[model samples]
Structures are given as C-alpha cells and as structure tokens.
Target: MKILVGIDTGVNTGFAVAVDEGKGGDLIQVISLTITQAMARVIELCELYSKSQVYLYIEDPRKRTWFTGGREKAQGVGSVKRDAQIWENWCKENKIKYTLVHPKDNCTKYKSDTFKKVTGWMGRTNEHARDAAMLVHRRSVRA
Candidate 1:
C-alpha cells in the first residue's frame, strides 16, 4: 500500500491524501486548516496513516505579484511565505519523506480541472483538497 499526501499551502491551507489499493484504486481524504492549525493537522493525519508507505507533498509559497498596499498590508499578507517556511521546517524535523511542489509544474498553474476527471473526488468545493490530490497525482515530476 502506498499513501501519497498533497498540500496546497497558504493562509487557508489545503491537503489531500491518496491511498493506492492496487488496480487503479484510490482512497482520498481532504482537509483545510488555518495557518495556525496547519502543522498540527498534518501531523495528526500522518499519525493516523502512519502504517503505510507515505509521501508528503506541499505546495511551495508563491511570490507576491502585486503588493499595492502600504508596508503594513505587505507585512500582514506575507504570512503565506512565512507559513510555508514554518511547515517546511516542521516537516523536515518530523522525518517524513516530503516534497515541495511548485504551482507552475502542477495544478496551480493550469487550474483545478486538471485532476477532476482523473481523481475519485467529487464536487467543486474545497479546491485546496483538490489541488492536494492533484499534487499526489503528479508527484513524479513535481516531487
């Protein structure tokens, strides 16, 4: 059994875990968390599925394109990178086999529809989870 975990990190981080049960089988679980709760939630998920071979894929922080606001706004909005850094460090410390996935090479660049047809996921809500699942799908090149 192989377990692949995908994460779309940001202020509202998204995660998707895909379990391969052989012969085109996929069991996916999804979650969304605030920046503060992100690390703990991921750790909890890891523990629950610890028995299987696991790989964690997290979306790298995107560079801010337009910070039109003043210094205060810039400082406040910079939480995205800061959170990614925190999670990256935390993941490394935990000794989980992890990969930092860039948005350009994966679903973030194209759109959520990239994996909709292929994955066993339903509905259009919670794209964070959807992107996470897609990351798992493209783990080979992106990871």
Candidate 2:
C-alpha cells in the first residue's frame, strides 16, 4: 500500500489523503482545519499508515501571495514552512520515505488556482485531503 498527502492553506487549511490499494489510489480521507490540527492529523495518519509509503505534496512555501491592487500577504507562509519542517524532521527520524511535490508540477497552474479547482464548492476547506488523494492516484498510475 502507498499513500499521498496534499495540503492547501489560506482562510483555512485543507488536507487530503489518498491510499493506493493495488488497482489505483482512492480518496481515503479529507480535512480542512487550523494549522495545529492539520499537523496533528498528519501525525495521526503517519502512525495509522505506518506500513505504507507516504508521500506528502504541498504547495511551495516560498511563493508570495500578492493581493489585487494591494501588497502581498505573508500571513500563513511562515506557518506552512514551519509545518513542513516539522514533517520533514519527523519523516527523517522515523525513516519514512517522503517527497515534497510542488503544486504547479501537478496542476500546471498557480497553487491557489489549482487548489480552488480541485476543491470546488468545498473551497479551501478539506481541499488538501482531496488533493492528497488525487496525488496518490496519479502516483499509482505512474508506478
């Protein structure tokens, strides 16, 4: 079994997890919540799926968010970076093979836009979870 995780952050953070069950990847879970909860959930997932290969796909943390006719907002970028760093360290310590995939690499568009499209009405809410599932599906096909 293999798993892919996707994350998108804005007004709210969205997380999606996908699991590969031989044939392909399927959406196993979806969540949109505060950064703290997101991190906690990631940890939980890691433990739950300890036997599976876990890959995390997150939007580039370095990208700046420029508002229309206004200055850029760096509000959540720091938190994203911090969360990523924590996850990275955890993976290393636990010997979990993980990969950080840029959103543009998968969607061929801006991370925000790609996230919006993938999430639809749900918007940023729980979108990451859906995105994670999609990433897993794609990975499974490629594998």
Candidate 3:
C-alpha cells in the first residue's frame, strides 16, 4: 500500500490524502480545517495509514507572502513558516517522511494566483483545503 499526503498552509490551511491500493491513484480523503485542526488530522492520518508507506507532499512555506494595511505583513495572520516548522517537528517526532513542494511545481505561477484559483473554484471558502486536495490529485496523476 502507498499513501500520499498534500498540505496547504496559511490562515486557512488545507490537507488532502491519496492512496494507492493496487489500483492506481485514488483520492482517499480530504479536509479543510484550521492549522491546529489540520495538525491533528495529520496525526490521525499517520495512525490510520500506519500499515502503508506514506509520503508527504507539503507546499513550501517560503514562497508565501501576505499584505496588511497596504504593506506586507511580517508576523501573525497565518505565517506559513511557523506552520511548516510545526509540521516539520511533528513529522520528526512521528518518524514521517515529508517532501517540500513549491506551488509552481504543482501549478499556479504565484502564491496569490494559486490561492485565487483554488478559492475561485471552491467558492472562496475552504480554498486551501480544495487546493491541497487538488495538489494530491495532480501529483497522483503525474506519478
């Protein structure tokens, strides 16, 4: 068995999981939740899929940027780096293998563009979740 996990982190983080059950790529599950909730979900997934070899595809946080009051925001308001660090620590503690994937590797030239396309398709709600799921789909097909 093989399992792939994709994650999009920010103010609204999203996570998607795909499984290869000897039948090619199949979307096993998807979720849009808070960063804290997403972390919990990841832990749950690790346990649920422990029997299989898992590979994580996480959107690199360094590429994300945000603005506030007409100027770039430096802290708070969902820091991708912070989120990534948390996830990284969790992965280390749990012995989960993870890979950092840039948004361009998946699609969407820019972070904002990625967010727009994802949110636009998902109706501006749960965009991160939808994007995360789409990333999984994209990678699975490519594989």
- The digit string of per-residue lDDT tens for model 2 on 26-71 reads 6656666776676677777778876356666665554434323322
Q: Rank order by lDDT, top first?
A: 3, 1, 2
**How many residue pairs clash per model?**
0, 7, 0
lDDT of 3 by residue, 110-138 (tens): 35456545433333335576667666663
After the best TM-score superposition of candidate 1, give how far the Cα of residue 74 lies from its true spot, in angstroms: 5.9
TM-scores across all candidates?
A: 0.69, 0.60, 0.69
lDDT of 1: 0.64
Per-residue lDDT value at 37 in model 3: 84
Query: Can you list the residue pairs that collide in candidate 3?
Result: none
- In model 2, the runs with Cα more than 4 Å from the true position are 9-11, 63-72, 76-79, 108-133, 141-143
RMSD of each: 4.2, 5.0, 5.1
lDDT of 3: 0.66
